[model samples]
Target: MTSTLSRAIVNYPNRFDPGVLSELPEHLQETIQRRNNVLGPGYTLIYKEPVEFVAGHGAHLVDRDGNDYLDAYNNVPCVGHAHPHVVEAVARQMAAVNTNTRYVQESLVDYAERLLATFPEELSKISLACSGSEANDLAVRVARYHTGGEGIIVTRWAYHGITREVASFSPHLGTGSPLGPNVRLIDPPDPRLAAPGSTLAEHMRKQVRDAIDDLERHGYRLAALVTDCAYTSDGIFTDPVGYMHGVVEEVHGAGGVYIADEVQSGFARLGDSMWGFSRHGVLPDIVTMGKPMGNGLPLSGVVFRPEVSDEFGRNVRYFNTFGGSSIPVAAGAAVLDVFEMENVQQRVLENGTALRAGLEEITKDSAYVAEVRGSGLYVGVEIVKDRATLEPDRARTEDVINDLRDRRILINGTGQSANVLKIRPPLAFTSDDVTRFLETFAEVAKDRL
Candidate 1:
């Protein structure tokens, strides 16, 4: 059984505790109270002591008092915060026109063409949406329509989105959002969990096969197996490349399509490739992307093979009020422009390699450091109470993150125990940022771990 401490800390590892309100600055305390009064209990803030950012540029943020913070956890502004190119494109489009897809828009068509070019040849069709939730929700509908099945499989702690349909499979949302009856949870492809002689592929394939059989037992046929290729919410498991091949094979054998949720792992976040699914060497039937597509604008989309979406497209009329709007499309195009102009993929690879090496060096002698794992900019540092036991240290992980926050560095935690330090900054993160983070993290680990 999981401990109460682990369960309580799993969701928001560094969330500010309301019990310590009096310890904060008077102004922040008042602001928190006002925010709570207006936003209600649905919203939560990060860090033991929360911060309010007034501005951001590149890989840094400025607080209310003008203190600079190194941002090592945000993935929304993949190119960078307030990037001039994206800003100019959005402003220019907004000044000219901002309308829905019903209108004839050259920018939307051009952007869609360019975006689709980045994907595999078979994934030729694109459908735009406002958020990852909507994209995943639509992907579910398409999968069910294509396969004539209602069952979906997701990782045990996966977080796809918040929409009613998407959240039904997002087990990381916690107990308040119970999984749907047709949803089956499988353990993430963690190499550590693999049997001694077996490969990660074998282990994952077995789990998927078990899930399909159980779904069948419940009178539900397989529709799709959806997962974030990076496994961000499930401890950032990105090792043993091609481990998903067998899993995808199992899913296909069970008559289910594969949906790669790239909200956190797409657009060169992984350095080596544009999409995380590419790292697995498996072609997904449907690929859903969001978060970084329009820099900070609300933009998301689903790209799939024509055959998979043909029947649905022909039978059902689909339109979103502001999904493929001109302004967001312009911003997305500008992001692609940055990717080309700045050679962001190479930069991510170099910076990510240096960052991981620095982290590994710093945590080498520490007993609390279980492992350093990830690909490219998306990395995780697992924390454990005992190296031998590998028991997750949720409290220590929270302390380390909050300590970094106090030092004007921002990061977060993930996984079921919330003990994995998640360091996924913008693709623009530089060697300087990596150095600063390593030095600060070493200092914090010395004091806290």
Candidate 2:
């Protein structure tokens, strides 16, 4: 009963119903009751009610009680939820061929080649996976095998995936989580380290150099320096183009691979570039992606320089049952088609500039807002306890989230202390939406701050 209501919450693809759905049947009422009993009488009871959602289309979600909401959280609805072209493509493919990896199918090969063309010419090979985690997990295995190394270096708060080995790469585990051996932690780039008159790119390069040097001195063979291009977890970023070059080169100097985790940062979310790594102006040996591809269908892959996989193939074998399934490939293809036809990236680029301007204007008077960082559609409003202390302000951040919900704007918080309001709406999100969000958000934030 509780899981049913939880599914009701999870399955809602758009704006959630603002009010407690009083029209629910007795069975759904019991489901909501059990949900409250298990999950406790918290936000869901008051601000967010447990309402069964029926369906979605474009940027709106309708519940069993029939309420509409402007979606700001879903990127997988790239061409808008239940896009007709995408739906038709999936239906056609489902009717034609939904085969496994064992077959030499056109859908798999065509989609693979199409995806590869999106990357640099040097990226010659691609491997299929079902999710971002699977892609990262596979990259880890390949990198370790290719470099013949044991140590892996990653960001302190980065999220790679849910699988066992990749979980070791994520330091968000906190106090009691189990972890793998040889995973080294590092702080995300602090502006203080580089300072004024110092180049951020060079600073990042120097830091990676120090990390590799320290690892070698400690008798650890470094295999890879894996990170999401955006530094999503650190809540901060090193600036300027090619900020990652020195680091990637340093990893190579230590005979390690440089893997770009593009699951969250790719598909033109950055606005200025097709891939997040493109903004860095450096090529990654391996690039993995998911979340937006297949327009919410479980389809993802790793694009790598062909030689990396060839070297690793000597020791390991990999295969996924549904990585490039017929339906998923069709969905992915439809996404590509929509991107080209709609020119969504161009709109995102323009909208991103507008969004940043609005947000900067929104938080100008708030002392709690430490910094606003990120580009394109992904923006992070960093919150601190005080300017002097720079401590995490989790409680105040929670209150602001509640306030936003009260205004019916669906936004959430992320980063180390869960203080930064991580904002990345769908590509379909407009300037008007940005303005509305800013108005509501500023009003909500002013109260809490």
Candidate 3:
């Protein structure tokens, strides 16, 4: 990295400066513009205007124009953008050792043990894969093989990955059977629709019970429940905690495995815990993790109950060429170290509290804003046509995302309807950053939302 980039970290998250990109060599500018053109027309957190990135440091993303963006959309940079500690660890390991799973790599073994240390005791065996999709597929295989069942249940607006098998379990297709039969679907028990005295947890329990019964009647005993710890595809934090406990218990009671899809909600992003399942106080039989695992590296895995692994082993040969490869292990080890030394999770808790409060403050007395729900750095601002009606104003939500980008702030949207303004910033996001984002959001909403 250049000294200019080195110096940028000291004053992170500064307002993006278009001049930096302008100052790029003529060829680079042409290439950047061409690249922007290639993206064509699309709803995105970024656009052609002032679009270019040069460097990153800690909690900021610097465009080619040297404009620093407060990184609230990058979990891949969990230890913070281009963290030197992780870079150095990766470099040293790459220089010394990096090989396939066929070798005796200490990094892999060490990382596996360290990773397992953070999981629940019941989760004792792990199988590494290259991406969240691969991990999800493996988890499903393990679940079905272990349970000797063929059914899977997922929530509406659920996203596992792009793999064919995982895709079959994903509700991203919404109104299609492309995901295969025997895959039961249900809505995430969003607290907004709750009865006067029904707790979110209790409501989810009822939903899980009903789904299980319906699936059983259809001659399909569930093999597993694959769900984002938070149903993040619907929105950032669906607060799947209380409801998750019920889901897991129900799955186990039905002789199915509870597969926690921690691809989005793991590694302390929720704060106060390493895994999202920990937040629910229930141990899942299988846990599929990715997203922030290697902080953006192509690495993911499934951790399961030992008995399940033994059962799976009896049926299929478990193998992946790059599973737990040396580089991923090195990067993962560094992430774990950073998680401890920097106390990143604790920082998430602190900043999460501040950010949520700031968002709530912006929505106060506003007709455009409905509710702000989430935990830790992962959050969602529900845009509504009318708060009392709980209707999603999709167009206005899109406008909010566009306007935020126009103002040089980075953010995005989620949900099947694409209306929840998502705030899943990197764990390194700070209070001042939160204040700035909310201030811009409030300003934008006052004018258009």
Best TM-score goes to which candidate?
1
Q: Per-residue lDDT tens digits of candidate 2, residues 273-300?
A: 8788898788888999988888889988
Order of the predicted models by lDDT, top scorer first: 1, 3, 2
Candidate 3 regions off by >4 Å? 1-50, 174-177, 195-199, 238-240
RMSD of every prediction:
2.2, 5.4, 7.8
Would you estimate the TM-scores of all the predictions?
0.97, 0.87, 0.87
For model 1, the local distance difference test gives: 0.92
Best by lDDT: 1
Per-residue accuracy of model 1 over 324-427 as CA lDDT, tens digit each: 99988998999999999999999999999999998898889999999999989999999999999999999999888888988988999999989999999988
Give Cα distance to truth, residue 434, candidate 2, Å.
2.1
Worst 10 residues of 3 by lDDT: 8-17
User: What C-alpha lDDT values do all the predictions have?
Assistant: 0.92, 0.76, 0.78
In candidate 2, which residue pairs clash?
242-280
